[model samples]
Target chain A: MKIITVKKIENAVAQLAREANLFLRKDVLTALKKSYRLEKNKRSKLFLKAIIDNAVYARKEKLAICQDTGLPLVFIELGQDVRILGDFKQAVIKGIALGYRKGNFRESIVSDPLLRGKPVYQGAVIHMDIVKGSKIKITVMPKGFGCENKSQLKMFLPTVGIGEIKKFIIEAVKTAGPDACPPYVVGVGIGGTADYASLLAKKALLKRIKLQRGLSPACPPKQQWREGTVSGLERELLLQINKLNIGPMGLGGKTTALAVNIEAYPTHIAGLPVAVNISCHALRSATAVL
Target chain B: MPYAAQQQYCRDCPSDGKIMKILNAPIQEKYIRELKAGDEVTLSGTIYTVRDQAHKRLIQDIGRGKELPFDTKGAVIYYCGPAKAPKGRVIGSCGPTTSSRMDEFTPLLLKKELKAMIGKGRRSKEVIAAIKKYKAVYFLAPAGCGALISKYIKKAETVAYPDLGPEQILKLEVKGFPLIVGIDSQGGSIYDKD
Candidate 1:
């Protein structure tokens, strides 16, 4: 049995938060480069250039890539054989506060949602899972409010088919439009309960955009799942979404979405649930294994 | 120079039949008429920053016949909630927030003589109508371009609503803030026509 201390985990997370906010992932950068090569519209090209430049400026100065430093969504992949020595949640929160303070990032969270507003950006949302290995892997993805606001969830009858799902995804993208900061990466979660469906969609977003076409790394419970993996659905949705005129920043162009990722789980005989979680161009995340 | 002010300083800059102007806050009607969609401009002088919560409060004050915290006439209201300013910097990574979130509160603000808005994303139809009715303009800054946009702010001081944290109303001194005029007083919108 391997025992990991909480302090080591916190230190790693603090660094993760700083790094994620500082740099755009390599795969995402590649996707942006591809879009730049393919785009024909002058305005769209100009906007894409600015985005590319912004990434450079953010890294060189160690400044945040965007003002909305975003909420820290922590996903931990734990090994069943490993044991943590301290309070996992508290350690993560402490790491976030430390990282944000040192990183010169903004704290956007509020203590009260319906009442007074606070700019406290230090809080984090964490999701942990146990896997087969003994290694602890943590990924911190800072989710901006603009993209988070545009997520959609709808439940359909079991008779509903792929055509309907495709339609719903397109409509959601259109509805999200400029608000979600298009040139987006859409994560579609199908099956499972309403809540799990949404969670599954968000999980799909945590995967790198380049790896989405093949076997998704983070699959739901292997036992209860029966539906053929929807990598095909992912490709179909990607084709449809890019066809929409909502180009970079919804200003009209060919490169509206960077990728589409879908995750599915087995559900009740009478139910079919779907969720879409859209992520902005600055897909901020940093991972560390302990 | 504030990035916006640098753009504003190029008042006489014209290229390919496109006329560019450098404008200041508290803008006048004649200048508003001269401006058209797709024109490039740099805004300088004083601009107020307001997000959804502060906007709702302003609307409420108008209903109660209370004086606004800042004069609205000829003002440019920027919709943004900037990151916390690091030590020695005038402001942090301050970029425009989504303007549509403030749409319902906008017509009321526009009626009070707000000449222009600095934000990212498209405004609603009601907002476009009000921009035409009030002869105001809307500008777009590239979304996710926060670090670059921060260069436009020369200084920032919260004028009111300190309790709102990032949503606080800041009076910013900006110069040559680069922007493509997205909407004009005539109701022409860059997004709408395209």
Candidate 2:
């Protein structure tokens, strides 16, 4: 068994927390630039330009791309053979606290949802998965409220069918409009339980934009098949979404959505759960393997 | 079919167009009611900061008839909760948060003689009603352009609720702060018309 020191995890979390806020991932940037070229509306075109310029400025200044430098969402893949030397949770929290403080990232986590109280927690959200390997993989995603507030989750009957799913996705985007900070990425999860579906939708967002070895990293390899075939479904959904003409900032343009990713799992015969998680262009997340 | 005076004025005006001046500023809210949509104004003054949590607390205090920690009358309120600043900087990527979340508390604040609000997105009907009733206006600074906006804020100091951390209310002194009119006192909204 391999022992990973808690200190290493702490340091990695802190550094990654800061880096994710300051830099736009290469995949996100490339997608945005592509949208900029393809967008037909003049107003949305200008808005997209400003977004790209903001990305550049944020990088040059080493500052957050947006003020709402969201809560620290840590996704951990723990290898079964590995053992942590110390308290893993505390180490991760410490890293998030230190990173946020040093980087000047905002503390968006509030102690209470209602009654308006102080912030009790430093990090935003942490999701962990235990795997077969001894190495631990940490993924940090700083999700701002703009896109987060627009997220929607619903459980439908098995008979609802694809037309209903398409309608739901479009309506979700329409209701969100400019509020989610348009020119966004939409992640859809089909099947699974309601809660599991919501999670799968979020994880679908972490899939890199680039094609790796002629296969989309956003979807699992065919050999490791899940309950249903979501890869083809995802590609079709992405094309339909872009046709919405929501544009940048919902100004009525061709580049409303950059990509749509779908993840699925087997569900009970009675239920067909679907979830949609929207993310803005910033799409800030980091991955570290130990 | 123009009146004599109007005819002369129309003839003198250029048919192509007139350049609209775009005023930019560090994010801050201060006396925004005095401004109107399509009116260009360069801002330089003191503005306070707050967001959903801060607004909720402030409104709750008002409901209890308790004194607020700061004087809000005739003040501009910026809808923001910036990231922490790097070493030696006044603030970090200080940009606007969404405006709609604070829509519930705005009318109450307006009753206190608050003048202006700065943020992005559409306000609720209650907020629009308050703007029309109280003659207050809302402005939009480009969202996601935090780093660029931070360059204009000359100084920032925490005024209250420091324990709120980033959500802490701050009193910021700004110079040449830039913005575009979003909601006018006449009940006109850019989001509505555009």
lDDT of each: 0.82, 0.75
| Top DockQ prediction, candidate number | 1
Model 2: lDDT of residue B78: 93
The digit string of per-residue lDDT tens for model 2 on B86-123 reads 88788889878788989989999999877788887778
- Candidate 2 ranges with C-alpha deviation above 4 Å: A112-116, A210-232, A243-245, B1-42, B64-73
All candidates: DockQ: 0.50, 0.37
**Interface RMSD of the predictions, in order shown?**
3.0, 4.5
Model 1 per-residue lDDT tens digits across residues A83-160: 899998889999988898887787688867777566675588889898998899999999998889999999999998
What does chain B score (TM) in every candidate?
A: 0.89, 0.81
Best by lDDT: 1
Candidate 1 C-alpha lDDT tens digits along B34-89: 77777777777999999988998999999999999999998889998887777777
Q: Which stretches of model 1 miss by more than 4 angstroms?
A: A211-229, B1-19
Model 2 RMSD in angstroms: 6.4
